[model samples]
Target: MVGTALGLSLVLLFLSVPVFLVFGLGSGLVAIFGLNLPWSTLIQVSFGAVTKHVLLAIPLFIFAGLIMLRAGVARRLVALAMAMVGHWPGGLGVAMVLTMGFFAAFCGSILAAITAVGSIMLPEMKKSGYPPAFSVVLAASAGLLEALIPPSNAAIIFSSLTNVPVSQTFSAGILPGLVLMVLLIVVVMIRGRAFSRNERAGWGARLVAVRRAVPSLLTPVIILGGIYAGLLTPSESAAVAVVWAAFVGFFIHRELTFEGVWSALKATAVTTTVIFSIIAMATFLAVVLTYTQAPQHLTAYLLQYGIGPITFLIMVGVICLVLGTFIEIVPVFYLTVPIFMGIALTMDVSMLHLYVVFTAFAGIGLLTPPVCVGIYTAASVANISADKAFPQVPLFVGVGVIYGVLMIFTPWLAEWLPSALH
Candidate 1:
């Protein structure tokens, strides 16, 4: 029954069926054959999935991201990053990485990060003589950082699915996120030298740019700082981010208008609806998997084959990497984390450690090919071919693998900050 469901799901996915439909089709098959379960349970599970309190973070975070993008925060951030790094070898590339990191901290969605930052930076990089392919690659690869930062919808969804503490999941992501950013910065420094033709500006101009961006930078501080300080939960932080972004983008910056707000709100509604639908469908499928004891059966088979914890971890990573290349991060989190959490617990892995491993692996999916949502987004914004942006996949994947290994071996990298806070 497990084999039948898995095979059918993969076939559906390959045939370009939407994820929710694929999940529903697979679950329906399992319900009819594997277990004489009532179909109403599927409806109940789908509805219950969105009723999760923690799941509130998803829409709020998405709204915050859309608001910020519509409000012109990305432009301010890019200007500040360029002012700071534009004189360095590969300064534009450095600016791209820096801006993406900043945006990720607040937005927490790769598509948002790529679209917002890419629209602003791609043109500037091109104007500065950066190769269009390099610009597209930088934007697409940096989008992966959105998954590793706090307030990330992926982290929220993963937490909801696995019943892991969302705060710890958020904290566990910090170091790994910074590490990935640093690795990307290094890559840009190496390849971006030829594009850094601007003269170094004096301290006065740099300071001015910093001052100009201070308000924009404060969005992340307000969002993450409020969460870390225990003054707010992720949902509250996301709401605060939306309010703050509105304040900064409208009255303070005078950039956002009524029409702008409406547009952002509409975009948020569409995105949230799609994400929720996917979550609901994935939940129904998870119910089927649980009812059939497929996870237990699979785990037992792996153990029977002498697969150790490390080998199992490697296999999980490989599977996520493959799936991620073709799927968006949130749905992947919804579908896999529940099944994998059971296996991880059976292996006695720490929940914190497992969260890190799963998230890092899932983050890889955002940059891989076939689906590569981030790459497609960046490519579209930069007016470059997705094929042109493909080379950066290996580079970003290398960074992701390094981060994943760090989380696997030095679980402390993910656990320490959360532990200290507790």
Candidate 2:
């Protein structure tokens, strides 16, 4: 039954069927034939996956992202970031990275960050003499911060699956996010030298930009600070983010309208549905695989073969990177987390650390070839093919790999903040 389900999923995936359906139908087949389960079981499992309180944060964060995008928040963020970094060699690239990091706090959705910031920054970068492909690639790679920063959907999902506190997961991501941010800045400084032509803004201009952006900049402060202050749960913080985004966009920024509000909600609904569907279907697959004791068998095999924790972790990172190129990170998490969780537990690895490291690696894969969603989204914003942005992927990916290695060996990189806060 396991072999049959795996075979069917591969064929459907190769044939270009939607990923949700491939997992759903393949697992449904296993439950029906192998377990002799009734159809209602599948329905129940699929529905139950999205019924969690933590999952509620996903849609709320997504809604906030759209609201900020339409509210001209990205423009203010770019201006603020430029005022701080735009005079250096590759300053626009630095500003792009910083802007994406700031936006990632509120958006949490990577592709949305790429689209919002890319639309605003790409044109400006082009006028500053930056290469079009390079600009797109930088934007896409920077967007990976969306998964690592606070209020991240990936962190929320990781917390849900592992039973860790969402706030701690959010905290766990801070160092890694900062590391990646600095690494990206260095890369931009080196590669962006040829096109670095922007003049430094005066202190007066910098202060003005900062003043204009203060309201938009309060987003992460509100969300993370509320969590740290014990005033709100992660989901509650997400709800507040939505309300704050709406208020800022509509009343303060004065760029959002009733129609714009409706549009953001509609788009959020569609994206939420797609993500929830994939999670539901992947849950069904997890259920079927558990019933077959597949994870148990694999865990025993690995243990018997004397696979050490370091070796196992490295292998898991490789699998995450490879699978992530072909699948969305959420589904990839569902598909592999079960099999690896037992191994992780048996080896005495911290589940929180494992999740953070693996999620970061998977995010890096999103900027890679064949199915680089971030690259494609940002490239489209600039009216270019993904291939044009392909050349810039290697350097960013190298930095990602190096960071992954550091996380693996340094463990504290993922554990310190959460522990310190505790």
Candidate 3:
């Protein structure tokens, strides 16, 4: 059954079938013919996979991001970021990275973050003489921070699957998120010359920028504060984010329109549907893998070789990087985590540390090619193509590799905050 399913999936993938269909059909074939399972089981798993109440956060965060985009929130954040960093060498690049970090905190969706911030910053970077290819890569790479920050769908999903506390999983992301932000800032500084033509903003200008940005800036504070203070669950905070964004965007800012709100709803629906479809398909594949004992057999194979923790982590990183090139994170997570978490637990590895490493590599995958969602989204936003942006991805991917290695050796990077909060 396992070999037949694997062969069918590989063939379908090579034939250019969409990934969700590949997994769904490949697994469904094995279940019906190879293993003789009832077709009704697949339906049950597919529907059950997406029924979590916490998963509501994904669409809400996405909707909030869309509303913010329509309300000119991205523009306000960019202005504040430029006022803070745009006077320095490669300052426009720096501003892109910084603003992406802020946007990531609110949306926790990489494509949304890249689309919103990229739309605003990429053009300014190009106008300031930044390379079009480099600008797209920068914004896309920075947008990967969304995978690590609080309110992240990936983190939320990880918690749901592994039985980790959602709040601690959210906390585990904060330090590494900051590290990635700083690393990107440094990369921009090293890779580019001073691009911004704007002189340093005077104190008055900076104050005005802050005033203009205040309403938009409250988003992260409200979301994070509510989550961290025990005042709201991640899902509830997401709900609050939707309402707050609508109120601020439509009322206080006076930029959002009824038409724009309708559009945001439509976009959110489309985004939500795409994500849920992948999850449902992947869940069916996961059920097949679990029943076939693929994870158990794989774990035994690795343990027989006396694989140590560091080497095991390296292997996981390699697989994620390769898979990420052609698959979305939802499928990747469903496919790999079941195999890995079992192995890691047998080795007494810290679940927090293991998951952080997993998520970080997954983020890097978003920066890789072929299936690089972040890069493609940013490129489209900039009216460019993947080939134009491909050259700059390697350096950013290397930094992600280094960060993954750091997470392996320094277990505290993902554990300390969660422990402290407890």
**lDDT tens string, model 3, 380-417?**
99998778899888888888898888887888989999
TM for every model, in the order presented, reads 0.94, 0.97, 0.96
lDDT of 1: 0.79
Which regions in candidate 1 have their CA more than 4 angstroms from the true location? 304-306
User: C-alpha displacement of 263 in model 2, angstroms?
Assistant: 1.1
> What is the TM-score (0 to 1) of candidate 2?
0.97
Give one digit per residue, the lDDT tens place, for model 1 in 1-422.
76777788889999999988887888677876678877788788888988888888777787777777877788888878878888888887888888888888778567878888888878878898888877786777777778777877767877787777788888878887888788888988888766655678788988888887788778878887887788998788888888998898887778888898898888888888888888888876787778778788887887789887777777777777777777877777766777777788888777777776777887777677788777778889988788976766687678778777766777777789889977
Identify the leading candidate in terms of TM-score: 2
Q: Ranking under lDDT, best-scoring first? A: 2, 3, 1
lDDT scores in order: 0.79, 0.87, 0.84
TM-score of 1: 0.94
**Cand. 3 TM to true fold:** 0.96
State how far residue 173 of model 3 sits from its true place (Å). 1.1
